[model samples]
Target: MAGRQRWMTVVCVVGVGMLTTAGCDGTAEPAAAPTSAATRSVTPPVPRDLFSPRPEVVRTPQEACGGTPFRAGAVRAYTPDGPRYDGPGPHPVKLLRMESDLLGMGPELPYQWTGPRPAQLVVCEYEDETFDSRQVGTCEYLGGTVLGATARVQSARFVYRVFEARTGTLVRQFTLRGNTTPEETCPETTYAKTALYDQQVESKDLVAKIRPLVERDR
Candidate 1:
C-alpha cells in the first residue's frame, strides 16, 4: 500500500464588528443583581456537529450573475466595520439574493438602506472555503527513475458565522462538509470547486440554521 499526502486551500471573507452605543443622557446604566442559575434564562447549547452533507455551489453564469436589480430607498446591510454594498455585481449581489431568498425574506430585508432607522444590523463574521486534496498513488516512468503524482479533492468544507447587525453578537454558526464519491475524478471535474461555487446549497443550509434566531430577534 502507498502512503497518501493531503493539502488544503483556504479563502476567508470576514465581516466587521458593531460599535456600542451610549445612552441619550450619556449616563451608564447600573448593573443588575445576579440571578440564581435556576431562575436565569439558559440559552440552548449549539450542536457540536452542525454539518450538511450535500451543500450548494455556484453552477451557471446566470446564477452567478443574478440578484435583485439595484433600487433606491432600500435598507442597507450594516456591519460592525461599515455598510456592506449589495449593488449589482457578479458575486456580491448574488450572495445577497441567495441569503435573502433562503431566509424567505425576499431580496430586500437585510441589505438595503433608505434612511435613519433602528440600530438592527446583520454581520457575516466569516465565510471559509476549505478544499482538501490527497494523493492516491504515484506515477512512474518506463525507466522507473522519474516519478509523477496525481491528486484529487476528497472533500470540501464550508463554515459560515452570522452575527447581530447592530450589536455585533453572534447569532448562529454552522458547517457544511461535502465528500466526493468514488466516480468523481480530479482535473476533469474538481469536486471542491463545484461545491464551492454552488452558492444555493450553502445559502439554504445557512438559512436553515439561523432562521430560528432571526425570527426570534424579529
Candidate 2:
C-alpha cells in the first residue's frame, strides 16, 4: 500500500472562574475587578506522526535465498535497543511472555539452532504502550468547588524487519499499531492499570505470516 501522512489533533479548552470571599456577616463579597491584557492568537506547530505506514515485503525470502526450499546455517534475532525492563524491578510478565512466544517458534522454523553465526536476521523494534493523565478542563460544583478533569491516553507501536545476513539486504517488513482509546474522568483521577502486551498483533500471527517467506512449500 502507498504510504500516507497521519496526524492527530488535540484540542484543549480552558475555563476561568471568578473567586469570591465570604464576609463575616455570612454574606458573599463581590470578586475583585478582573485585569485584562491584549492577547494575540499564535498557531502552534503540528507534531509529525511518530508511526509509519505498514511496510510491504521488499524482497521475498525465496528470492533472497536464491530459490525455494530455503535453508540457512543459522537464524538470529536482533533488537537495536535490546530488551527493556521497566524501572529497577524484574522484567514485566508480558514482556517475558512475548519473548517466550518468539522462542517457541524456533522448533518449527527452517534454520538450525545457532545465534552467533547468523545466516538470516529478524530485527525487532518495539515501543511499549504508555498511559498518562492530562488535565483537559475543569469541573465546578454547586458550592463553587472546582475540580480538574483529566484525560488518559495510551499509545504504542512495533516494527519488524527481516534481512539477509550476508548481504544485509531487507527482505520482509511488518508494522503493528497499538490499540488505544482515550478516557476522560472528572476530579483528575489516577490512570488505570493497563496490560503491557495488549497489542493488535501477536507473535504467533506474525510468525504465520512470515513462515511462507522462509519455508518452501512442501
Candidate 3:
C-alpha cells in the first residue's frame, strides 16, 4: 500500500508540473516584428530652375504658312542666356499690335502685349513658294530630264512688335526674313523654321536693342 501511495504522489507532482508549464505557455504573448525603413515612401527632388522665371518654348505643329509657332508659357522671358526675367507684370512696355503688310501687300500680322493683368505676345509667320518647270526634249526623249527640271523658291518672313498696352506706344519691332531652296522633289513644307527665326534671331536682336531703351524709360 505505501508503494502504491508513493507512485500516486509521484504521478500527481508530474501532472501538476505539466499543467503549470502549459498555463505559462498559454499566458505568454508573441512579440511583433519591427517595420523596415526601406518600405517608406520618398519624393523625388525637383530642379531648381523649374520655377526660376524662365519661359518654356516648345515647338508646335506647323500652321498654314508651313511655319510652326513655338508655344511659350510656364514662366516668362526671351531666353535663358539672352535676357533676364522681365518680371511678371507691366513689362517695360506692353505690345499692342504689329503690322507687317509684307512687301506692302500681305495682310497685317497678329500681335499683342500685356503684363500682370494680361500676358500676351503675338508672333506670326508668312511664307510663299513657287515652282517652275520646263520641258526641252522631243517625243523620243519624252519623260527625260527637262531643261529646267524643277525650281522651287521658298521665302519666310516674321515680324514682332511690342507696344504699351495702356497707351499704345510702340516699344520695339523686329523684321526677320529667310529663304530656302529645297530640292526639286521636296514638298512645299518645312518644320519649325519660323520658330527658330524668332527665338534665335529676332528675340535676341529685340532684347539687345530694347534693353537700353527700357532702362531709359525707367
For model 3, what is the error of residue 1's alpha carbon versus the real structure, in angstroms, after optimal superposition?
Answer: 99
Q: Tell me how candidate 3 scores on lDDT.
A: 0.32
Query: What's the best-to-worst order under lDDT?
Result: 2, 1, 3
Question: What is the clash count for each candidate, in the order shown?
Answer: 19, 0, 2
> Residue 184: error of model 1 in Å?
14
Considering lDDT, which of the candidate structures 1 and 2 is the better prediction for this target?
2
What is the per-residue lDDT of model 2 for residues 84-136, given as tens digits with 9 covering 90 to 100?
21233211111112222432311123233123332334433333333332333
- Please report, in order, the local distance difference test score of every candidate based on alpha carbons: 0.34, 0.36, 0.32
Candidate 3 lDDT, tens digit per residue, 130-158?
22222221112123354222323334454
Clash pairs, candidate 3, are 94-163, 95-163
Model 2 poorest 10 in a row by lDDT = 89-98
Q: What is the alpha-carbon lDDT of model 1 when measured against the actual structure?
A: 0.34
Which of 1 and 3 is the better model by lDDT? 1
| TM-score computed on alpha carbons, candidate 1 | 0.28
TM-score, every prediction: 0.28, 0.27, 0.24
